[model samples]
Target: MDFTNLLATEVQTFINQNIDSDINRLLLKRSSFPNVTIQEIVQQIKGRKVAQRKFPFLLNENIIFPPNLNLEQASSQSTAEYKAKDIKGKSFLDLTSGFGIDAFFLSQNFEEVTLVEQNPELIKIVEHNWKTLNRKADFINQNLEEFLESLGQAANDDFRKFDVVYLDPARRDQNNKKKFLLEDLSPNLLEIEEQLHSISDKIIVKLSPLIDISYLVSELQNINEIKIIAVRNEVKELVLIIENKPSTVNQQPTTISCINLESDEPEFSFYINEEKTATSEFSESLDFLYIPNNSMLKAGAFNIISKKFGLKKLHPNTHFYTSEHKLDNFPGRILQVEKIDGKDLKKNDQFNIISKNYPLKPDEIKKKYKLKDGGKRYLIFTQSINGKEILRSV
Candidate 1:
């Protein structure tokens, strides 16, 4: 049968049984299921597996899941909560609201939330799920530029001013290639910045984590804050908050916050200059190695981190730090030096392996040394400050 959306209940139930099974293995024996195509079944299973952690609302019966790519690009539950934190608003407008995940969360903080998506199929799915989830939001199918023009045309003072206007622009180009620049995004946020500011004093735009923080701040005006969102140590999203400032003549330094939801208390923040001018001492060999999580690393506060924490860097380029004394409140994993090796590992056949700024990759090291992944001890391989490949254990 031609599909309009996700699979039916009966099909979903069948998928639930073999959801954890190998997708490739199932495709090999595709003939077993004659009534339904293997592609549909696989899609149902894969989509559900992804939603188990990303958006649990899909667990609800009758709610349809979008393509895996959409799910991958959509904000996670934790990230959405973090982005919406302290987001003061009486009404919210999402210009390029995709799958409606952010809109759903943003609606909780605002009295009224409007999501605009030009894709009819996506909007239809979101509208259906919004009702299923018992969430209220006005869903509109229109281009972001057109929506803003309509607001100007109405010219009605009766229209309530949005406390915050949110935009998560399409990060893909005409060929469906992933785009990284703000100008490359659909609606070219830079082009409509004035219009967006005219409609609302406060604006929040979700950007790629790979964006250069300095470049972003320079290109956009009135940006007050930049938040790097990370989960389980992996940097996921970058959020830029724009506010109306009184003086356009002078620009203030933007606050950069690195937030990780992995640990119990997960926030490491600092200013851009703090990272630039700060300096760290060098260490010849390993005593205790400390590697900051993806969030801290992405924040690019390397020198400030080392100087503030009283740590030394092995090599100028290697971000890994070391210290003779154990330090608390470190933003990342701290491992003690169990052993240091100049050649191939001679002791401890079974140990976890970590290679950083070295010629050999983790897989190659594992394969060559015949070592497993996890153990009580850790074997780290890196190039020292003296430019020698050194191996250390912790």
Candidate 2:
């Protein structure tokens, strides 16, 4: 029998019965079902229309669909949380509405939402999902360039004015390598600058967490805030907010804020300029060194971090530095030196080693030191003030 002849109920039951089994593998093994394709199975058995297989076992009811419409694990929790906090009754536009996750969330905030997607397949899926939820929205299936051209031609009164504009560009190359910076994406950003500037008062861009925050801050003009979002202790996304109007008044010094969503306590807020003020001449006798977190390191405000905590930079770019005293609220691990002999490390028992912005890998150093991994003691292998190899502990 042809696959389409199989009732939706039968397809749903098949998916429920073999939910744990690899459908692709099963299909490959059973060559007799020649007409049943994987995509057909996905379309017929998954989603709300099919009651038995609708839940997919991996998603909560709040998470209506899987990320990218793939059966694999989703990237984030449902847009419900973000929707509860920021979206409501505003005019919103999703400039790059891939999979419509952001559009779905932003829809909760705005009464009217316009989702512009270039891919026809994705736009169809988004439309289907939006209709399933029964949310009102305008789904525009057009390349961003063409859409912007049409928007520009419309009179000011006829144009759709958005309170918030969201953009999440395709951050991957044709070969599937990740694009770290905005300029790396296709269709050139310059063309959209004037168009983007004219359309919305507030713009939010979702960027790859792997990117250097400093590079983004320097490159993107009119940015009001940068949020490093971590979900369940894992950094997920970086949100950059740019205001339409740049402030004419000189603002307070820029600060780096780290929000630990996992922690019960308040967010960790550090002043970068204050950290820059704390910089001192490096002294070997200094008791402790403050290491900034990986996010701060990626931000590359070494001078600011050093001076805020009154620490001295070991080297200009080493990212490791020392301070005479200790700070209760230091952002990164605080290593207190119990012993400082590199020669002694070679002779000691095993050491649990970690390397960051340092030359040598842990295994290479472990083989050289003849050390094992397990330990209560934490050892940081890094470069010192003179650019020499050193070991320190917290």
Model 2 Cα lDDT, one tens digit per residue, 217-305: 57766676666665434566667667767568665544555544543323455544455464545543256766666555545556766
Provide the RMSD of all predictions against the true structure, rounded to 1 decimal.
3.8, 5.6
Question: Candidate 1: TM-score?
Answer: 0.85
True-structure Cα RMSD, model 1? 3.8
The superposed Cα distance between candidate 2 and the true structure at residue 172, in angstroms, equals: 3.5
User: Given candidate 2, what's the lDDT at residue 300?
Assistant: 52
lDDT per residue as tens, model 1, 1-394:
1243344656656778887899998877663455677776776677788889887767776666667777787898778877877786678898887888887786687878888999887888788888878888899999888888888887674463688999888888878898888889887988999888888889999988888888897899988889988888888889988997667457667878888785754477777777778998887656678888887888887788788788988888888888888887788888877445545565337667778888998888878767677767777778667875545564
What TM-score would every model get versus the actual structure?
Answer: 0.85, 0.74
Clashing pairs in 1: 338-393
Q: What local lDDT score does residue 381 receive in model 2, on the 0 to 100 scale? A: 69
> Per model, how many backbone clashes are there?
1, 11
Q: What is the C-alpha lDDT of each candidate?
A: 0.79, 0.61
lDDT comparing candidate 2 with the true structure: 0.61
Candidate 2, 391: how far from true, in Å?
4.2
Best candidate according to lDDT: 1
